[model samples]
Target: MKQIIEKKRTLGLLLVILGASFWGIGGTVAQRLFQQDNIAVEWLVSSRLLLAGILLIALYKITHRQASIFVIWRTKQTAFRQILFSLLGMLAVQYTYMMSIAIGNSAVATLLQYLAPLFIMAYYLLTRHSALTRQDGIAVTLTLVGTFLLLTNGSFSTLSVPFMAVFWGILSGLSLAFYSIYAVPLLQQFHSLLVVGWSMLIGGTVMSFFHQPWLIDLSTWTFSTVLYYLFIIIFGTMLAFWFYIASLRYLSPKEASLLGSLEPLTAVITSVWWLKISFGGYQFMGTLLILLMILYLTVFQKKQRER
Candidate 1:
C-alpha cells in the first residue's frame, strides 16, 4: 500500500511535468504563428477557449454518464463563484499569456508565467497558511534574479524585449496564481475536466463579446497555421489542462505549480533549437538558476515528505 501510494505520487509529478512541457512547446508554436503569420491573439484565444471547452464537456458527458455537468454549477452561490473563476482566473490567465506571446517570444513569455510561483508564495503568507521556509525564500530570490537576467541579459540600462511583454507576462503570472488557487475546491468536488470545460466555456463566451473571433479573416489561414491552431487547441490547451488537473488529485496546487517549472525550460530549449532565438551567457546562467528551483523542490520536498 505504501509503495502504491508512492507510485501514484510519482505518476502525479510526471503528469504535471509532461503537461507543463507540452504547454511550453505549444507556446513556441503559437509564437511562430503570431510572429510569422501575423495571426491575431484575440482570435486564437477566443477560438481555443470556445472549442476546447465544448470538447472537454463532450468528453465528460461521454465518460461520465451518471454525472451531469450542470450539477457542478447548479446552486446559485456555486454558479456565481464559477463565473468569477471563469472570468478572473480562466480568461485572465489564457488571454494574458497569449498577449504576452504576441508581444514577445515564447521563451520570455513562458518564463514570465513561471513567476506565478512567487505570487503563490506571497498569497500563502497573506492568507496565514503555510509560512515560507528558507528554501522557498531561495526559490523566490532565484526566480526574481533569473527573470531579470533573462529579460535584460545582464544589462541594467535597456530592455531587450518590448515593455508590454513584461506587463502582459506579469499579469499572466498573477492570473495563473489566482486560477490555481481557485481550482482546488472545485477539483476536490467535481470532475476536473468538467470544471475546466465549464470555466473555459464561460470565459470564452464572455471574451467573444469583445474579441469577436468569428469576424476575423480566416481566408488568410494556410495549412501550417491551421495545423498550428489544431496543436494549440488540442495538445496545448486540452490535453495539458487534463493532465495538469489529474495531477492535482495527488498533489497540492503549490506542488503542482512548482513542478510547472518544466514549462520555461522546455520553452527555452525549443525556442533556441527550432526558432533560432539567441541567448547570452548571463541569460543561460539565469535559465540554469531557474531550473535549479525545480530541482530544489523535487529533491528537497520529497525528503521533507518522507521525514
Candidate 2:
C-alpha cells in the first residue's frame, strides 16, 4: 500500500510539473506567433478553446465509456452555473492571458497572472468580511511590493512593461482568481474533464459569434506557424489541463498549487533563455518576492491547518 501510494504521488508530481511547464512554454510560443506570425489574439484564443474542448471531451468519452458526459446539464441550476463558468471563468482567463502576452512578453504576463492568489485573498476579505491574518498581511505586502518593482523595474519614473500589458495582466490575475474559486463546487461534483471540456466548448462557441475564428486568414501561415498553432491547442491547452486535473487524484490541492509556481518559472526561463527576452535585476528580485509570497502563504496555511 505504501509503495503504491508513493508511486502514485510520484506520478502526480511528474504530471503536474509537465502540465505547468507546457502551459508556460505555450505562452512563450503564443508570444512568438503573436509577434512573428501576427496571429490575432481573438482567433487564437477562440480556436484553441474550441478545438481543445472537443479533444478533451473526446478523451473523457474514451476513458469513461460508461459515464455520461451530459450529467452536468441534468439540473437547470447546474446548467446555468456551467454556462456562467464557461463565459466568466474560462473565457475571461483565456482572453486576458493571451492579451497580456500579445501586448507584452510571456514572462511578465505569467508573473502577473501569479498574482491570482492575492486577488483571491482580497475577494474573501471583501465578501466574508474576514479579518486579515498576519500571514495574509505579509503576503499582500510582498505582492504589492513585488508588482511595483516588476512593473517599474525599481524605477518609479518609468514602467518597464507597457501600460496596456500591465492592464491586461492584472485582469488575467483577477479572472484567474474568479476562475479558481468559482469552479470549486462544479469540480467537486463532476469530473474535471467534463467540467473543463464543456466550459471550453461553451466559451469558445460564444467567442466565435464575435471573433469568427473560422474566418481567420491562413494564407500566410508557414509550416512552423502551423506547428506552433497545433502545439498550443494540443500540448498546451488540452494536455496541460488534463494532466493538472489528473494530478489531483494523488496530490493534495495545496501540493499541486505549490508545484504550479513552476509555470511562471518556466515562462521566465523560456522567455529569457530561449526567446532572448531581457530580464533585469530588479525584475528578478520582484519575481523572487512574488514566489516567496506564495511559499509563505502555503507554509502558513499548512501550519495553521496542523494546529
Candidate 3:
C-alpha cells in the first residue's frame, strides 16, 4: 500500500511537470509568431483565449457526452467570480506576460512571472487558514532570490530593468497568484475541465470584442502557423490544463505550487534547445536554487506524511 501510494504521487508529480514543460513552449512559439507579424499584443492574447476556449468547449462536450452549453443561470454568482478570476488570472496574466516579453527579454519575463508561487504562498497563509512552515518560507525565499538573479541579468545590477516592464511583470505575478489560490475552491466545487472550459469561454467572449477575430486573415494562414496555433490550443491549453487538474486531485495546493516551480526550469531548457538561447553562470545557479527549494518542500511534505 505504501509503495502504491508513493508511485501514485510520483506519477502525479510527473504529469504536472510534463504539463509545465508543455506550457513552457508557448514563449518560444509566441515569440516567433509575433516577430513575423508584429500583431497587436491584445489581439494575440485575446485570439488565443477565444480560439482555445472554443476548442476546449468542443472537447468537453465530446468527452463528457453531455449537452453542450448547459444553462448556468442559477450559478451566475459563482460563474461570475470564475469569469473574473479567469480574465484577471488567466487572460490578464497571459497578456501581461506577453507585454513583458515585448518590452523585455523572454528569460526575464518568464522568471518574473513565476513570482506567482510567492504570491500563492502568501494567499494561502493569509486566507486559507494554513500554517506557514519553515520549508515554505525557504522555498519562497529561494524563488525570490532566483527571480532577482534573472531580473538583474545575472549581474546583480538592477539598473537594466525598465520601469514599465517591472510593473507588468509584477502584475502578471499577482494575477497568477490570485488564480492559483482562488481556482482551488472552484475546482473542488466543479470538474476542473468544466470550470476551466467555462471560464475560458466567458473570458474569451469578453475578449473577442477587443481582438476582433473576424478581421483575422484566414487566407494568409500557412500550414506552419495553423500547426503552431493548434499545438497551443490542444497541447498547451487543453491537455496541460487537464494534467494540472489531475495532479491537484492528488496533491495539496502548496505541493502543487512546488511542482509548478518546474515551469520556469522547463521554459529555460526548452528555450535553450528550441531557440538556442543560453544563460549565464548566475542564471544557471539561480535556476538550481529554485529547483532545490522545490525539492526540499516536496521531501519535507513526504516526511510529514510518513510520520
- Per TM-score, the best of the predicted structures is 1
Maximum-lDDT candidate: 1
Q: Kindly list the per-residue Cα lDDT of model 3 for residues 1-307, writing each as its tens digit.
A: 9888888888778777777767777656767677765556666677777777777667767887855345433488776777777787677767787788788766567667777777777776778777787877787788777655643446645435677787888788787676666677676666666667776666667877767756776676788888877787777766666676557766665666656666676666676788787767876887778777767766877898799
Q: Put the candidates in lDDT order, highest first.
A: 1, 2, 3
Where is the poorest 10-residue window by lDDT in model 2?
252-261
Q: Which stretches of candidate 1 lie over 4 Å from their true place?
A: 103-108, 144-165
* lDDT of candidate 2 over 1-307, digit per residue (tens): 7678667877877887898789878877888898899898999899999999998999899999999989999999899999998888889988998888777756467667767767776777788846567865676677667655654467754536798999998898877777666776787788889988999999899999999888977899999999999999998888886677667676654345445556766666688898897778897887788678656654565467556
Candidate 2 has a TM-score of: 0.80
Q: List the residue pairs that clash in candidate 2.
A: none
Model 3 C-alpha lDDT versus the unseen true structure:
0.70
* TM-score, every prediction: 0.89, 0.80, 0.86
Question: Which segments of candidate 3 are over 4 A away from where they belong?
Answer: 1-12, 66-73, 147-153, 157-159, 218-221
Total backbone collisions for each predicted model: 0, 0, 0
Candidate 1 is scored at a TM of 0.89
lDDT of 1: 0.81
Q: State each model's CA lDDT, in order.
A: 0.81, 0.78, 0.70
Per-residue alpha-carbon lDDT of candidate 1 for residues 30-64, written as tens digits (9 for 90 to 100): 88888788888898888889999999999999999
